[model samples]
Target: METKEENFPNDSTMESIKSLTEKDAKTFLNLIYALIKDNENPSEQLISNVLTIFEKQLPRVAKARQNKN
Candidate 1:
């Protein structure tokens, strides 16, 4: 898949973070570390805040598949 910054909302970037794939998640985790690792202050709380507004598409997809059964 193409990784485009514009693919997501700038105003709600945190919300978008929650919906990332496993690979994307790993990449993002690394990014977070890179941003804060040097400061001795990486915030897990910030990550959770982002996830709070994030919606999970996998569950919806699974539900749709079940409905098609």
Candidate 2:
């Protein structure tokens, strides 16, 4: 019996959600949860990896999306 309070991610989570695509963000969040389910140390290597990919594509995506406006 989980409460509504336990179902929502906090502000930082929202920000991360905003930073990623809906599909990718959901996948990422699930992966993070799985990693933590083991109760082991969480290294942000996957995050850094994703950010590297995003940062590389950032300029192009921004330009393309901006042009659509």
Candidate 3:
């Protein structure tokens, strides 16, 4: 399997990760854990659910960053 470094060809992704707040980082980790919890590939429904969550979160994240600026 390709490692994360191999998956991301540039350092910008790592830099963005470093900028994440602790809570945001934990939320991402939790999402990853949830996806891999069963030690098997996540089901399509679960992927759909996660994508829905991201869809809901993106605006909130953008709003929060806008507020910070």
Candidate 4:
């Protein structure tokens, strides 16, 4: 029997995550934890803040990758 692979919509986001430095990754994780810790359903503003954080990191990630080349 053959198995099929499933693709995630956020695969690119996952790839970007791999490029984060250890400290930044930890900060991101901590922020996510803090945002969701008390709320069963996170607010839209909270979600927006999370996206803003990730978007801010993308520039740094891209710069680091460029420097590596």
Candidate 5:
């Protein structure tokens, strides 16, 4: 069975993050902050899923930023 990380496209590039724009990034950050600040009790499965997404995707974003400097 394919995992969510495997199912997610590996074709993300710097262009994608760049396209997120300041406003979009701010909105996304706000949403994440709200979720964290609210003390929402996420299920283990939900936390696992989100962590998987972050592990798979955030490195690319970080790498892209690193390369930009």
Candidate 6:
């Protein structure tokens, strides 16, 4: 059986994502799952709102990555 690690090797996003608290991570994950599990694609504003929530939770992580570039 293929493990998740083998399925998604070299995931650079994980390093930045690890900065999120477990509760925040789970909340964001639930939001993503809700989007995918729906039949229709979400509206642009809905997507933007979800991204805004994520940014609020990880402002420092976002700023750090921006500074690195």
Better of 2 and 4 by TM-score: 4
Q: Write the per-residue lDDT of candidate 6 for residues 1-69, one digit (tens) a residue.
A: 868665342434455476556775676788777865672755765666555555454565545655876
Error of 5 at 56 (Å): 13
| Local lDDT at 39 for model 2 | 44
Per-residue alpha-carbon lDDT of model 5 for 3-67, expressed as tens digits? 87664535554344555557656755665566567655766555565554455555565566567
Clashes of each: 0, 0, 0, 0, 0, 0
Q: Residue 66's C-alpha lDDT in candidate 2?
A: 45
Q: Across residues 1-69, which tens digit of lDDT does each residue of candidate 1 receive?
A: 637764454543444454445776675457556655554434665544334333343344434444766
Give me candidate 6's TM-score against the actual structure: 0.41
- Score candidate 4 by TM-score against the native: 0.49
True-structure lDDT of candidate 1: 0.49
Which lDDT value does model 6 have at 10? 40
Residue 52 in candidate 1 has what lDDT?
33
Which one wins by lDDT: 1 or 4? Answer: 4
Worst 10 residues of 3 by lDDT: 7-16
Q: Candidate 2 — what's its lDDT? A: 0.52
Name the regions of candidate 4 deviating beyond 4 angstroms.
Answer: 1-12, 38-42, 61-69
RMSD of 5: 8.1
* lDDT preference between candidates 4 and 6, better one: 4
For residues 2-62, could you state the per-residue lDDT of candidate 4 as single tens digits? Answer: 2343222255566677777788678778877887776555586776666666666655674
Angstrom error at residue 37, model 5: 0.4
In model 6, the clashing pairs are none
Clashing pairs in 5: none
Error of 6 at 10 (Å): 9.6
RMSD of each: 11.6, 9.1, 5.8, 6.7, 8.1, 8.2
TM-score of every candidate: 0.32, 0.32, 0.48, 0.49, 0.42, 0.41
List, residue by residue over 1-49, the lDDT tens digit for candidate 2.
8698754555544544455556665665566566556544445665454
Clash count for candidate 6 is 0
